[model samples]
Target: MELNHMTEKSLIRYDVKETTKEKVIWTLVESLYEQGYITSKDEYFETVLAREKVSATGMEAGLAIPHGKSSAVKKAGFAVARLSNPIDDWESIDPNNKVELVFLLAIPEGEAGSTHLNLLAELSTRLMDKEYYSRLMAAENSEQFIAALDQVSVKEKEDKDTYEKTILAVTACAAGIAHTYMAAEALEQAGKEKGIRVLTEKQGANGLEDEHTATMIQEADAVIFATDISPKGKERFQGLPYIQVRVAEPLGKGDELIDRVLNNPDGIVSAENDTESARGSENQPANKKTGVLAEMGQAILTGISYMIPVIVAAGLMMGIAKLGAVPFGLVNEINDISYATHDNELFVILHHLDKFGFMIFQFMYPIFAAFTAYALADRVGIVSGFIGGLFAAGIHYRFWGIEEGIPSGFFGALILGLSAGYIARFLNQKIKLNKNFQAMKPMLIIPAISVLSIFLLNFYIVDPVFGGLNVLLRNTIEASQESGEIVLSTIIAAATAFDLGGPINKAAGAIAIGLAADEIFPLTARVLAIVIPPIGLGLATVLDKYVVGRRVFDANLRVTGNTSILLGFIAISEGAIPFMLRNPIITIPINIIGAILGAVTAVLLGAVQWLPLPAFWGWPLVENIWAYLIGLLVGTLFIALANIFIRHMLIKRGRMTITS
Candidate 1:
């Protein structure tokens, strides 16, 4: 797809006075709704907000693409606005620049599927052109801006030679948004300047989706992945000579790299230019160590991003349910009232709300796995990854034999992802197609082959492994319960602390879920276990802020921490992620200690509410509610003290730095 084809001659306005983030969103939302582009403001706002919560649709270079599919949308339309002011959001890397421009997209819910993702990929790639973006930015009015984009050839061509025989490349700094597209623009202009027919592909935070296919790739002399991101669909360039380098390197030494790829008779990026490459290599040491801290920061942010939708849906659902019900003390009185049977509207509404929330919760695993996979692989991974997650969840249910069954953990989704991804790449690499079949590639061929392989592979491989895992998991849960909740909590807390939110945590939680399935404890007990870790960590952070550090500590953490306890009262260990990331060493141990303590206390206090489901936000999960609260509180404080002691010891020894 070309920019021209996608760029419609719709009414677009510029220099709008939307200073705040909410204003920008609401302005576009309301505008779209009023203009028949959208049907309702509420639905569109929610859809956009949901996407934002997913990963900040914020693009690089002070741009944010906030687009969504909603029942409120009446038509597909794009509204471009330049923000007079900016507001804070996690995805905004440069707070100084704010969002100079916002691309608000509204599409009818019917059209809001994955199709927009492809459009996003195209727009992102094109906007990479600094010259292009500059034109858009510099335009005094909408007409000039539209005209400039109109001038660019958006028509994607099919001729293989048009893209091959000479190199076109895009190198972005973070393989995110701004720099990725900028690099592509740089490479394109450079190629055009050198009179080379070239097509450049972008590698951004969103990942690679569109690419030059078989004929074009086959005819190409070479290719380049000029970003830090992993090159998706790598098999497309299997035999082509490919150069991988940082985007900055290309920006600094484009001429040299280009010369080498195009057979520089002189010496640039050539064997003769080995010294140049060596000197470039001197800077390599600095570039390669992107740093664990940076990676961790991104991972934590990503995890938080994944968790939002689930929490929002769950919270709203539960809130509605709560609002619908009568006060516990008044329930008996209400039940005996004459009008009670006839007027259960509130109760009925609450039930429906709860049911709706539960349905959304079912999608949580799939969303988590899909987003994680997307974070790993980009746009190409979303659908496949989501499907993979569904498969994993299915497998989990069958294996666990839960009366309702186990929802697949994130790990299972990952397995499905790896299978689908590699298989897709393999097919792309090995299969040869003529021009006649080219049109079928994206629409049918790739997805068809990829899903088929994933299904077949899972059938043979994942199925059996799941069977073995089920037996082992069931027996272990039974044995552990026999040994008791103290042993179980210790194991879970350890797993929860390990790797923050990785496979280990998933495994432990799966075990808890498994135990719940077997009637080992009532639903309430399971709920308590699930939520304790976060509460413990949160309590520790509150009591000993120095250990967790004020730098990382924020008001939200407090809320999250409390929520974890709420979740813990119901027994969901995943609540501890935020606290765990702050100081893993102190946090993990604290969680482990707290889990054990909580378990012991619960048993001693004879708090016995048995429902596997997380206590609906912690209130009713415990039968002996006071004992449950005491256990949670005591366990939390104990863990906090443990964390403080560890931090103090580390500081005294100079093994850790308070400021660092």
Candidate 2:
């Protein structure tokens, strides 16, 4: 099918009056349904909503592409709408940017991965052209709209003289959805305007499209690597001179990057050198004025980013499995229960599912290590770091005089993973191989050498040193608990709530989970700490409106509050991060204080959680459910009152404003 075949005049709507997102979506979907492109409007609409929930399709420009592929779609097509008024909260990268132009796509399930992607890609790239976007916005009628869209093309103005100075670019982002294509389009457009030929490969959500060939890479004068994450097949550009920047950089400064490559060709760094420089920066001492600590902080954040999903998924699965097994009496409490003891089919299934979830949890440390290494030293670090993490997590080597496995946990994983990554990076730099053997260096040589080295180091050096340190730390905490249980609980709770999901919070959580894994049930204060912040902020939202005698919060804040409360009940502390970020001075102190109070109260009341999981749904698993509830209630009230007081003070001092 032609790329522009879906852009029919019949699908175009000018000066639309729809205000809300739902109305806008319905109006566009109705147009497609009327035109027979869709068989079931409701099904198509629901599919589009589901897509929205994944990530907003809104572009950096004032355009939103809400699309779906479903069996309800009879044909692959698009409906265009130019709204009379912009829609707020459309999930644009720029929070202030609103959606004025909408492209609603309906694709048959069979065509979604093929023709649909091509058409979507074409539209996304075309939308980046300033002239094209302006024409679409100015078009007065359906014919004009179709004309403007038909004018959209990927080819830029040709200049044969500058063909030899051709630039090849690859664009990618973590999501690999909008920014990837947007960057590609921007570079293409900028190259055209600057009289330079540009070929772009977009490594996007739909997978690599319009990939540059080896011949094209060799012919190119310069290369651009615009990606947040490390690009796939980065070795392809190893010898090439390139400029690397964040994927979002090209959106506004594509022309500048292109000009820089053209004007100062010598300034372009080789891909290998760029990688080494990045590694060097990461390895810089924390005491250095340069933000080496920030780089380390980023690596830790990357590890946490990968770890959270595993924990959430496993926690939910185990919780649901426990809920199912509760009725069967196969699992009465959260203490370690063996599925082997259960004989009933239903109970066995539930028990095994929970066990399967824990099995997934086993990879958490390995994944954390691998990605952390990957963040530091690219792909080579991944294999080495993973092996290092496996060793950290109770992997025994008897021949090396290690009869007993040391449970190093997340802390040990962090140290070993970082070491493995640096060692792999160092090896890559020090060991030089011919071009023919370079391929084996990454695949065979790096992994074999780095893994062995990390294993030996971890087993002989790190295991004994850090392992003993880990034991000492745990013993110190245990000692504090014995002398002053409430004090220790309060401190742990405060640290967990201090940063929401940041390093401090993760540190506290790791300690709690580590203790729980060691069969210390009552010491799991991290569970209450995780749930308290979100619940407290959510309660504060409601109290601000009722007790404060006015709606002190905005509509968005109220909606966020509702979502936070729901997620908080399920033990998702990250849900409260947005609120904390908005008013850190007030929110942080209130959250920390409230969490400490709740944790202390829970510990004092003999509330104990055997499992590492924390959620209201797991209340039945708590040794004292009443105490758990009481702790939560007390914390929520304390946070609510404190928040109200702070906001009232700020308002009285003329530093804050009431929304309504």
Computed on alpha carbons, the lDDT of every model, listed in order, comes to 0.54, 0.70
The deviation in Å at residue 247 for candidate 1 is 2.1
Which tens-of-lDDT digit does each residue in 260-308 have in candidate 2?
A: 5555432334333333333344332122223555456556556655654
Q: In every candidate, how many clashes are there?
A: 30, 0
Segments in model 2 whose C-alpha atoms lie over 4 Å from true places: 1-167, 172-197, 203-209, 213-222, 226-232, 236-291, 332-343, 397-406, 456-595, 602-628, 635-660
- Least accurate 10 contiguous residues by lDDT in model 2: 281-290
The residue-by-residue lDDT of candidate 1 on 428-482, one tens digit each, is 4345456477446444776786667666766677655655555555455546766
* Backbone clash tally (model 2): 0
Best by lDDT: 2
What would you estimate as the lDDT of candidate 1?
A: 0.54
Off by over 4 Å in 1: 1-171, 175-226, 229-244, 260-307, 323-343, 372-380, 395-406, 460-467, 476-527, 537-593, 604-627, 637-660
